[model samples]
Each structure stands twice: as C-alpha cells, then as structure tokens.
Target: MHGARKAFACAVILATTALTSGQSFADEEVNVYSYRQPSLIQPLLDAFTAKTGIKTNVVFSDKGLGERIAAEGENSPADVMLTVDIGRLDTAKQLGIAEPIKSEVVAKDIPSQFRDVDGDWVGLTARARIIYASRERVDQTAITYEELADPKWKGRICTRSGQHDYTLGLIASMIVHHGEAETEKWLVGLRDNLARKPTGNDRAQVKSIYAGECDIALGNTYYMGQMETNDAEPEQKDWAASVRLIFPNAEDRGTHVNISGVILNKYAPNRDNAMKLIEFLTTPDAQEIYAETNFEYPLTPGVAIAERVKGWGELKPDDISLSEIAKYRKAASEMVDRVAFDDGPAS
Candidate 1:
C-alpha cells in the first residue's frame, strides 16, 4: 500500500471510531463510493442498515469514481463501489480495482448473463434499450435495431450522442450480433435516418418525439417511468403520453439490456461487512426495493417487476451476455467516430 493511501485510510478509521464511541455497531460500517445518484440507492442502503445495523458511509458522484479508487490504491477505504452500466464496471475491472464477489448466494441469485465471468461485478437491476415511437406519427407495432437503418425511416429518428454509454452499449451489441464490417454499415444507415443531430439524454429524445421533431427515439425502459411520474415537471407527463414503447426485436434476438451494478472494491477495509451488504442487496426483499423505488427489473428470477414498468411492455432482453457485448465496445465507439454518426444525417 502507498504511504499516503495508508495514512488516509487510517485517518478515516480513526474518525469512524471516534464517531461510534457509544454505538453497538459502530465498527460494522461499510464504506461506499457510488457513481449512482445517492437518491437512487439511499432506500436500499437504509433497508440494509435497518436489517443488519451495519451503517453505510457513501461518497457519491457521477464521474471519475474509478479513477479515484485506482488512485487510492490498496488502502482505498471503499468497501464497495456502485454504478450503472456494464461499460463502467468493465472499465473498473480493467483498472484492477475489483475483487471477485464469489459468494454462492450471489451466484445462485443473479443469472450468469448479469454477472462478470471473473466475479468482478454483479448486476442488481436491468433496463432495456427500447424505442420510443410517437403514437400520432409512427404506426409501427414492432421494430428491430437493424430496421432503424431502413431507408423508409429517413429523417424520422432521434437519439442522444452516439458516443453516450447507452448508445455505445446498443452499438456494441450490434457489433456482437453483426460483426464489425456489417455493424459499421448499419451505423451509416442509422445515422442517415436521424431527424436531427443526436442530442440530449433519453428523456430529451422523448420530448423531441412529443414536439413532432421525430417519430421515434432510442432510450432506456426506466426513463418512461421517470417521465410519467415526474410531478416536479408535470409537462413530462404529456411527453410520456405522446409515445409508445417498442421492445426492439422481441420476436428474435430481443432488446439490448444493460444493468445497474455493484462491485466489491479490491481493497475493502471491512470485507465481511461489505460482503454481507452485497448479499443483502441480492435478497428478494432488497430486490423489491429496487423495483418499487427505481422502476427497474430485478435480477432475482422470481421477483416481480414494478407494475408501472410492466405496463410499458414486456421486455425480451437479448440473450448475449453483457461481457460479450462489452468486448465490442471499443469497436462500436470507433465505428461511431469513423461514420461521423454525431454529425447528424448527411444532407
């Protein structure tokens, strides 16, 4: 361990010890470094604490978390790291900051496709990348990822930056399915079909559909829930009302799916407690919290999906493992740049 990292870890230990002077479970805390928004995971953490009395200390941010932990080295106080997306989790493994989450409980609960082959990470929830098609303008009952490139849809699709992880994930899946040469050709076709320069987050794409700027868009399944239930921005309800969800390729290879996952930090100071929390997270009760609170599909086989999520449509996820898809991410990203996909449809 580096001296600076060791010293910092020691300081954190001492501070935690001081704070827990009178508490029964003071020494049972687990440190978390999360790339997910705190609000998204707070309920789960609270449930864990309530069940086991193991307190969670979290440092949350959306960017640079992997770099932060890598810089912290062997003495990193982070017991667990949480984030969404296979790309980020694979990046952490490549950075060498992960420990195998090798619990029989986890292996049995989470399906193989949702787990890293080396046990470096485990997915807790899954969301599909589906098409949001305008109810008024688009009459298609079904679509395929490949169909997006058909000349019939020219100047009729909207999307976020092709470089975004969500877009890249879908693109990566395309590479896995079609190989580099054909996937590259598909990217050109899809790029030319764009209604405008790929811009905005998934929600923004839905908003564009509402405005008649496009007839269809690519977005995650859960964004629909967030938009429909958005009381703070009630206008989002109308946006949600304007579109219908299409699970691409439901009759064939199925829609591309991604996960929100957790990893056991390589240098977990409280390894046992961290493992306990991880195990707790996979249990049916915790999985229920994930579904009800986040409107996501639980990884546990028997757990029910959120009713609102079910209302959107049945999701038949692509059977290819995320690890397989991740293998093609670099190629997918390069293809995006090579095709000048973000430049919008060539006029």
Candidate 2:
C-alpha cells in the first residue's frame, strides 16, 4: 500500500467513537467491520447510540476485512458487516461468517426484493445504474440497457474498468437476464462503442462526457449528487451540470438497481446490540438520515429522497433479485476479458 493509503487503513481500523451525548455504549458496544467509509456511516451510528444507547466500533477497509474476519473465526470481535454491494454481502454469507437474522422489524420495514430470502443480509439503500448523457451533445432524454449495444452509439460511450465491482454487478445482471451467448454479443457491441478504453472511477466517466470525449456513460445514481455537492472539487459541479441522467430500460425491465447493505456476523460478541443496530438501520428514521446525507434511496417505504434527486424524476427500478444477480459474477468477469471490454473500441 502507498504511505497515505496505509495510514488511512490504520486510522479506520483503530478509530472508535463513543457517541457520548446523553449516554454512552462504551460498555454495550457493537463492533462493525465495514467496507464503507466511516464518514458516510457515522451519522447513523451516532443516531443509533443516541436512540438506543448502544455504541458502535468500526473497522473500515476497501478489501481484506472479510479475510481477516474469516481468519479470526468464531472468536471475532466483529458484530456487524457493512458494505456497498450485493455481491460482497452474498460473499460474506457464502463464507459462512454471516448469521441468518430473524428480526420482525427488519422484515416489515425492508422489502423482500432488497433482502436475502433467508435473512442473512438486508439492503439499506439502493441506487440505479443509469446513463449520464451530455446535455449539449446528446439530444435524447431516455435510453435502455439494450440500446447501449446498438451500433448507433458506437464510439459514443465511456465507463470505468469493466471489472470493477459495480460494473461487475451490472454485467452480472445482464448475464442473468440475458443468456451468456447473447450477453457476450452485447458485450462486444458495448466494447466497440467505447470512446476510449474503459478507465477511472464513475465520476471520471462523467468528466469524460463533460470534456466531450464521450456523449454518454454508465454511472450509479448517488454519484451525480456527490459531484454536484462536492466543494473540494468544485469543477465536479460543472461536470455534474454538463450531463443529464437517463434511467435506462425504464419502459421495460427497469434500470438495474444496486445497494449498500448490512449483515450480521455469526459469532458477533454483542449479538443483541448488533441486532438492535441492524433493526434500527432499516427503520425510517435512520433511512431518512441516510437519504439526506448520502443521497441514497431508502429501501423502506415513505422515505422521501433529496429534493434535487427528486427533481431527476422517479425511479422504476428493475425488480430483479440481487441475490440471483450475484450468481453470474464469475461469468461476467470472464466475458469482460473475452470481449476485451477494457481495451476500448476496435472500430
């Protein structure tokens, strides 16, 4: 790891906030090993402590936290697993580290489509994989996942690495809904459409559109909010303004939706408090906080989104079960290489 990244990992692993306003859970704490940034989850943790007086300890990692927990086995101090994608959540479940939950509150508040059938994991928020179209260059207001493969769009699309987890989730969904053979053909078409070799984070794809390198791109919904509200990178605001988001496949199977979800560690030392925290995260109050702070769509009903996001229009999320989507990741990873999707267009 680079020096800065190593320092960041150490800081996130050791950092433990007490959330001590009225009462503290230093004694009744729940340990969370997360794949999400501490800043993104701190508000909810603080609210959980303030409401239930059960504090949380977090260890953040972009990778390897799961391996460490697996190595620790039943003696692990980890109480909860928090992450951003169904594939990761399902991986934890398959690794036998996740406990199957039996919470009525979670079942009632979270929709069945967003939670595992056996309750090993539950999605807290959802985002759509949609198109970011350049305002000045693209005339259309809508498109479809199928349409990306159309020859009309050749040399007009850009994306991050085809093998990135979010992109993998999308590719996995494509494989699930469309058979492997057809999906490969679609992959070839998409590959031939790239404005440049697939590169950068999702935000960089938007920047490419802003720079006129491509007319449209694939990105998650929350990133638009992040780009628009970013103060540190004020130019990202202009990047945000240059593109209009199009919800793909909206008139058909609906846009492919992904999630930020949570899990219960099977041997969580603080099982009761951990369950409390899980149930709390699924409730409207916490969902509202998540919606306002992170610009994510709440899985729970009746939670309104940010006004700016609301203006983008309603989401007709493809109701495909993400659990089913997780099964095709290996095939999707293979297809990316088979088609040389990251090498840009061959035309």
**Each model's C-alpha lDDT?**
0.89, 0.87
Best by lDDT: 1
Query: Candidate 2: which pairs clash?
Result: none
For each candidate in turn, the TM-score is 0.94, 0.94
Write one digit per residue (lDDT tens) for candidate 1, span 160-255: 999999999999999888889999889999999999999999999999999999999999988999989999999999999999999999999898
Error of 2 at 295 (Å): 0.7
Error of 1 at 123 (Å): 0.9
| Model 2, TM vs. native | 0.94
> Per-residue error at 290 for model 2, in Å?
0.8
| Model 1, CA-based lDDT | 0.89
lDDT of 2: 0.87
